[model samples]
Target chain A: MEITDIGGVLCNGIKEGKYGLGLVRVRGSIAGVFTQNKIRAAPVIVCEENIRDGVVEGVIVNSGNANAYTGEQGMRDAREMCRIAANLLGCEERRVAVASTGVIGRKLDMEWIRKKAPEVYSGLGNSVENAERFGRAIVTTDRFVKKAYSEKARIAAVAKGAGMIAPNMATMLCFAFTSAKFDSGELYDMLRRAADKTFNRLTVDGDTSTNDTVLLISTGKERVERDVFEEELCSVFYSIAKQMARDGEGATKVFEVRVDGARNDEDANLIARAVASSLLVKTAIFGCDPNWGRIIAAAGYSGADVDERITLSLSDGRDEVFLIDSGRPLGNEERARVLMEKAEELVIRLRLEKGNGKGFAIGCDLTYDYVKLNAEYTT
Target chain B: MEITDIGGVLCNGIKEGKYGLGLVRVRGSIAGVFTQNKIRAAPVIVCEENIRDGVVEGVIVNSGNANAYTGEQGMRDAREMCRIAANLLGCEERRVAVASTGVIGRKLDMEWIRKKAPEVYSGLGNSVENAERFGRAIVTTDRFVKKAYSEKARIAAVAKGAGMIAPNMATMLCFAFTSAKFDSGELYDMLRRAADKTFNRLTVDGDTSTNDTVLLISTGKERVERDVFEEELCSVFYSIAKQMARDGEGATKVFEVRVDGARNDEDANLIARAVASSLLVKTAIFGCDPNWGRIIAAAGYSGADVDERITLSLSDGRDEVFLIDSGRPLGNEERARVLMEKAEELVIRLRLEKGNGKGFAIGCDLTYDYVKLNAEYTT
Candidate 1:
């Protein structure tokens, strides 16, 4: 497969101190997923339109201003972004996908974007440094830029987002590029499945964003086995999703919950998500308390209807304790406390004595800084 | 009406230092509202049955341990608590309602309860001191015991609860006493409606507890108009609900959200509840930020489909600002900021220009203190 690292793409800032604009070129067909939130941003709308043709040359993305709810002007700005990217790449405007993330309810800085278009275009290069710039350009409130891929397969992706999480449709900007050949329909199906298993299962603050988008672009420059490509893409997406969860707004550490032997996958998922998204659960983890009751309570309210036939366990990779067995407390208070205090990779496991359906969710502990970071000043 | 406060109520600690047991002696009829959570506690089950005949002498309540998820032993303990109260109050066993609120899943200290029953009964007195002791006896983590009453109608109530705030059936313990005459049928009907408008509309932390119960009692010692009784009872219940909302775990301010002019009350309630229960909205209120976007976002995702024809306003009793008008910002940033910073009672008003239906919810802002109070230690 003729795979190339995304080294040299146009990346710049429409606003100073914030990398708010970027364009990455790839010769391929396009497939994508959009936010399930009915109130979508203008860029999400544009991305949907551009990808309809099943052919895309690249993607143009920005942060700092999610062009959503800015009325008709928001639509115009999104279209103009694609137009600019198309001009720079010498492709049809319909071939350039667009995405925007950050502060919602504002119009994009089209005037600044227009003025800096030439500069960003001129800076395109095919180096790892260029690709790293793409990483740096897409962040919003994210402490670190996240990228994942299989070097052997040349499937690389960069993602940006931390809060407003509870992704119904991967609420963030994620762009993946692959040199492997695949039809648009095939790529779309693969992306949709991978995203559901990964991004859709994650939640941070439980505030779904207005602009959640994920795009997979296959250059068709080289052919690869479908199963291998799917596996690699899913791995990369899952990795990025984990990073987003860990970097959740004011997050202290990653917390993973796995519900096993539920009545079904949906019930397992509901149980896992309930525990992961519970503020009480998050705070308990933050406090380093073996408050397994909160976990069980969350599960009880999840509508899973597992009755009292379940076991709850907690660990920090080293210290592990089964806090509840079949709705009964194990009463290993000291060991549970020790496990909770470790603060690294907290794992909550729930085993329902039903059928063997299992599901899991990755999230982060809630912290005071989360409140400070997201809601300190009136905007 | 022969007005009398809840005096001559036997109250004592089931566990030392935690005044967690009580029996109120009132020759009255009782009606109650319970939690909607499918996972109900033993006390709830007992109360449901005991108060079924509409004849009740008093309530036996315990704090420091919520008798929920305690299995068969829990049910027996709750029944035994009622039996003891019935014996002490000189009434049938079924005439005494039971409630326990504190930590869930742990069985009550039955030995302590049985031993202390005689002391509590012996010390009962018809004095304000006795009534206040009843208030002090039924609290879990509450900083203040909440009470509301109308002296003229001889109606009064006491309640206790703090965390696990979201309630399909208000998860706290509320026991109301009245001298005004009303049958169980009428009392039940009135209590149901009043509780729905009051207790059922309050949320904090969004965790519906397994044990939430509210009971209303009448001595049938004097006759009163149904309208007067209903009005006074609703007002008192609403006042108590407001107190609970304000005192939510670690809340700094009471948050009231009103949705008016919706297609129907159900939709209106959906919108109001969505905003009230939102983590972002609560956190924003906590930070005193006039971040109206979070409010609109919450409403947008509330399945309300409110298009661009809605108005969102925020006020703190006096200061007010129309933040959004028909999906457009009013640009009254300073006023909104001023209104938010007051930190006493924050009211978010949403007006949909669709119909005249209206609904409201009372909640509390999410605070770091709430996390500390609810999740500091493992059970």
Candidate 2:
């Protein structure tokens, strides 16, 4: 399978910078996931309504206006966007999914989109340049484009997000295409399972957005084993998730928390997410202070079954330093400090002597640049 | 009630700096609340065990080390502190409580405490200067002392905290004295209710500590109506809570979110806490941007039953500007910006079309200084 075509063009009445429209032209069975946030964007609502039959021809996405909380007019604008895309692609409107990201409580510039939709459609092609353009067009505060390709399964994935990120689909937009044959049900199940382990285990600032959407489309050009396809799908998703964490607004390093030996998968996931979402732990990591107490405290308050007999270690992928050995302080500050200082990606490994469950999460350090970027975000 | 005696002394063998000991001497019934974090500090454990009998003579506290995760030795150290205080104050060992704050995963400097405890005990006296000293000694990163008094009900309170603050008691240490006559059970009930409304409704960085403790001691020197006593207690707690929010590390403004017309009390509180705890909302406030979308999105994801018909307004306790009315955008950015710029205390009032439940929460804006203070806290 392969991507048929992709294109991106400025569509918010701006010639350059911060706002644009992107289009992906591909015919396949589709499986999608949207934000669980109560206040969903207009595009998310329309897409949910249109994707009921699990068939899709293309996706239309925009940046600089979320088109959320804009009442009935917002809903109409979302439908009109799908209509324009459908007319251009010669597909049913219901087969054209739409997504938006950016400032909430605003209406889409429909006139600008109506004029630029044809341009984006005309430029569609299966090229690295087109993929990069689509990735760049969908970003608001993201520092760079995020794209991952799995040659073994012939899958390509692109994601865009920087802030307002948390579990249950962060403020992000992801579109993936594959050539392997798979029904909508199989695709949905595989996508959900992969996302639960990747995108759903990421937190940047502990803020879930109103317009998060992820779509997986299969072109059915080739067939592969189910296990092979699933493994490759997860690989692509993991790559994009790590990129999102590394590029978190104002982030200098990626922080990963892995929890093992919990009573159940739920408990393990809870503990891992708590550590990754903790602001104190993030700041401590940013300072390279090796403050294990913050990590333990976060686990304690995670509403999971935790006890004193837990071991914790710090790792920089090459070396590991144990800070706590089964509730006993090792006082290995020197080694821990050295590891934190030298590690580009910091890993906090917690082993609880409870059961046989494991989970992990990825996050980024809290820094002054995060405050600066977010403070001036909409001003 | 009056503060019979209060004193503070440097306890880390330092003449002056960020480490000290504080003492409060009184003799009456006492009620206390400790952190809900599963990893309790040694002092918190000792205090919980000692306060079971609802009797107290005095309190001993230090701020150089949290005395947490020290195992058996930490417990022994906490008891020894209470024993020392009891011996000096001529009371039973079980009648004295102990508390510690500052760096965690460290042993208490028992030798220094044993030496400095006498100085603090000798200097104990009821005076504004003594209260100020007590306030100063317990602070780690706080820029100012936090104190509140109720004249009509004869209640006085002092709190010290700057970071690692969240609901169910922050990393703060608060001690309140009252002359009104009340049983331990009544006092406990009153303290819990008042604290639930005040201290428990505050969030700075959403990081609850393992060493938070709040004690309310009664001298039983005066008889007052229960209603009046409870009112004064709540007022004093409110004042101290607001102070803590204002003094939050690197904070420039106090942000309050009040939610009304929720489906129930729990929903209202969840919504308020969600808005107050959103880093995005806090950063937007720091930049003085009238971005109501963040507030609305926070409420939407608060695990509450919210809809589009909610009304939202911004106020500085003087003029009010409505940003959303009955699901419609009012576009009152200019007025909202003026209010936010001029207001030291920013209030976000949200009215839902669901029910009659109401609740509120207090928080501080996320700023560069906050990141600086916390990142370099233990380093």
Candidate 3:
């Protein structure tokens, strides 16, 4: 798989990393998934319409002003973006997908797009620098660029999201490219299944956004076994999802909640998501305090079929400390506290006695910087 | 309608208000509501069982340890608490209801209870000071006393909760008394209806506690009109609920999100609760920034049938500013910012174009103190 060309231009011409226009030129069949939010952005709507035919020539994404909730003007601006990108890339207008992320309910600066689209297209090239630029261009409050490559499967993926994240998608924007041969139907199914297990099980502040989009384009340049391809695809997605959580607004650390032995898969997912989305649990992690009661309470209120015969433990991948065994406190305060203070990556393991179902979710600690970044975002 | 007798004893023998035992000895028919969390506390289980016969001669409450997930020993401790209270108050053990709040999975210090329960009962008296002590005794992290009285209907209520609050109940604990004559069935119905509208529509940290309990007792001393009693009962509950929001852990301000013109009441409620529970929205309010996009995005992803033709406005009771009108940005930034900065109590009003359904939720701003308090709660 290969990214034939990619480039980014600062649409607002500030170069302060605030506003950008990204262009990725490739010939492939595309499959995409969008935010389930009822009030989708205009760009998301246009991309949904464009991707229906399972063919795409390029992608145009802009940051700094989300073309959302701007009424008819927003829709027109989104389509005009595609038109500009298609005209420069020598592709049909309906074949060019468009995406935008930033402050919601704002109109896009059409003049900047009209000027930068051609410049970005002209500078397109296949290089690591170009990939980094493209990753940087699609971020709003993100602290770092997110990119993942699977050498074995020849797949590359980029993602941008910091806040406004929750299960079932968020304000997250992700794009992947591969030269492996796969039909659009197969690509769509694979992407959906992979995302359901990765992106759909992530939370940051528990606020799903209005402009979340993920696209996978197969260039059909090589052939690989379905099992190998699916495994690599999932690995790429998992890496990007972890980066999204680690860079969550002002996140200092990222954690994963794994639930096992639930009554069913649904119950396991519910418990894991509830714990990951709980503010109390996030704050406790931020403070490096082993407050297991909040975890239990979150699980209890998660509408899952939970009972008293549950076990909870914490780990840093190497060392493990049991906080509760069979729903009884083990009072391992000192060891748990030390693990929390020292762990680079934390994992909370909860095992129920109901059945053999399992699920997991990734989340970030709620820090003061998160509040500061989001509170002062639009101001 | 009257306190009859109320008192509190320092259970842990520390006068700094860390722990206390509260006893309210007023014979009446009782109606109660408990947390819907699956892992109910031992005290919650005891209360549920004792209230089945609709008789409550007294209530024994403790702060600092929640007898939850303590296995069989916790159940025995809870029953023993009721027996101790009943023996001291000269009431049947089966007629005494018990409630507890604070850390989960900790066994109650039964020694303190056996020593302090009689002391608290002996000092029982019908006085405002006694009521204040009782209120203080039931609080864990609450910042101030929460109590409300209705002179017209002879009703009084007290509540204790600051964090771990959400819709469908929380870590909140409330007790109300009235001398008005009402049957247990009527009282139960009234309390449920009032709580459904008031306490059930509030959010602080969006974490429902396992020990939330509310009790309403009616003594046969006065006879008020049914309509007047119900109206006053709702008013009292609303007052207590508002206080709980205002005193939310580390909170400096409280706000209400009012959603109107939704497709149905359920949709309206979903939207209101989503907006209120949004951390981004709460932080924006805390920063005094009118980031209306977060509000709109929260509404969009609330699983409600919302559209772009919604109007959003902010008010401080005396003044109002519209941020969005009919899906168009009004750009009233300066006015909205000033209102957010100056308003003592803020109200966010959203009008949808679907139907005539309306709902409202009360919430507090997210602050650094909230994170600090919860992070260090168990440590």
Candidate 4:
């Protein structure tokens, strides 16, 4: 499941050393950052140091057990993972970043990694098959593998995330390697901006995980301009984010709530996110009620600088629109029919008189399937 | 359903000329205001002007039809109801306040008013039958009548609001007449404060009605200090708010989420409300999962200054404590069992290591019954 539309690549293979997919080892010049949660995994410490110098060669990732909250033993296992990966790849242990995503509060099996790391390294390749395996290896409750690749700057990227997602961070993990050239500082800034527009705009169950991370490594095989790389990387990041939104738990329709004419960009985001996450609005969308009252009511109580006199337009991804002025629906029967007939996407526009500000957010309708999926998830 | 606790002198009668419920029409002085929504109602306009000059004697209330959104014809009907009451009470029409609560967008029939006013005035008396009838007459979708009386102040307050509630100005129509002797200015202040803390704290499906109003009438019978009257009035109002929350559609348990030590009061409220209103947390409560993770996650993403290292505690009331600290559950199995057994009322404590600020919010569990209630509401 590679997003070939984006020019990125992913690879996964088994290791014969102590640091296999299920073992412990941090190897490769791959820089990464962990979620800012206080209860971070030991792998996050290793990943943070590797990125401190603003450069990395590769990443070592494993699943089946997340070495988080395991006390001092967790740290020792993480260090041992780095030693094995570094020795095999002929790189210093400090340059290699490590990441693990699985059940928490468990220590890694270092002996298995020491035996499997060599075989996994030997199998690594820059082919589509490896990319698929990498996507599958990082998954936990995900229904499908998520990977995207783009060729705009001759760059490659891939990611895996599904549930327990919310704003600012997601519960899953992602790793992207690109051939384009860029410094570590530039990559960090670009990743933050892209994430703000992408991962930060999503909410599956509004839960942020303790072991969430994204590691971006530059192979430096191609020397692309800094500006072009940033732009293309942002585009690719947004594309993957859209895919994540589409794959939201039991989601059928992906709704993009775009709020304009707010007091500021932050205000717009606040108002838009409130509407997107409102249960009334989501359920109404599921029932196809076209209940404009719920929509206006959500905006009014969003704690945003909203004036009742703001003009509103509700469109269904088309020319059909319902215009609301001064908190009352305007127009005749033809307009109502048009709004009802249009399908696929619902676009609500709010023009506030306060200031020239805007907000964009992504969401999905709340179907009965969504309730069923989450209610019986563990069972 | 008469709330006999907040005892007030009882009087119920039919008014042909005023349409209905026109038993008590005291004509001397009055003060009143209307909702700011542009969709003006006929009664709102008539009452807005008559209540000026800090004097109102006669009040004409009609049920079965709300004279709202009927344009000029509705305004005329509201004035005519007041005119009949004023003429019968031998007072200036300007001293008469009019109120109409029922279905929206329907014009009132003046012929019914021409015959009902004198009959109602003739039957005015302080009796339990009238008080019960008054409570019953004001209802719309409520399963039972609600009326309250306070024996300490010889003041009684009765309200009618069951559906389409969620308050900014107030929730539905509440006409509370007190016998306490207080100045008009003092009464206005007390009413405003009580309305803010009580009606404003509740949310029923988060829907704000177009015809919500709360009017406090002082009969000037019992002389008391202004401060004492304010306290009594607030207590009475809080009782009404609690009933509304308990009677909320499909709510199984009432929960109070308190977030303390936040950076500011606004941030605390944001986090507390976020956790209280989270569908995931509510559903978990319904399932009795004792899942504190969802509650903390909701606070984290509530756009508040959340320190994940902060302390958290869950209780099945005030005494039976369950999870304390972050993710570590109680080692005592007996304590966990005791907590799980008592699930009538739950409280979640989210302590952030910021400034000394706190917020309190109340909500109910989300169940399949709740979904059924809302999903099939209009249908």
For model 3, which pairs clash? A1-A179, B1-B178, B1-B179
Individual DockQ of the candidates? 0.44, 0.54, 0.61, 0.17
Better of 2 and 4 by lDDT: 2
Output the worst ten-in-a-row residue range by lDDT, candidate 3 chain B: B6-15
Interface RMSD of each: 3.3, 2.8, 2.8, 5.4
lDDT of 2 by residue, B73-99 (tens): 999999999999899889899998888
Clashing pairs in 2: A1-A179, B1-B179
Per-residue CA lDDT of candidate 3, range B164-216, in tens? 23342337898888878898899999998888888888732234578889899
Question: Could you give the candidate ranking by lDDT, starting with the highest?
Answer: 3, 2, 1, 4
lDDT (10s digit) by residue, model 4, range A1-379: 2422223332455523222362122222344545655456688876787668865545677766667655578888987777777787677787667777655554688887777777667766656666665556666556676666557675455665654223422356776666666667667777777666766666422345556677766655567887887777777767766676666665555667788888998878877776676665665565555555455556655667765556666667656464566544464335644554456666767777778889877776655555454445421
TM-score of each model, paired residue for residue: 0.93, 0.95, 0.96, 0.76
User: Which ranges of candidate 2 are over 4 A from the true structure?
Assistant: A1-15, A164-170, A203-207, B1-15, B164-170, B203-207
In model 4, the Cα lDDT at residue B223 comes to: 79
Q: Rank the candidates by TM-score, best first.
A: 3, 2, 1, 4
Which candidate has the top score in DockQ? 3
Q: What is the overall TM-score of model 1 with all chains considered together?
A: 0.93
List where candidate 1 sits over 4 angstroms from the true fold.
A1-15, A164-171, A204-207, A317-319, A354-356, B1-16, B151-153, B164-171, B204-207, B354-357
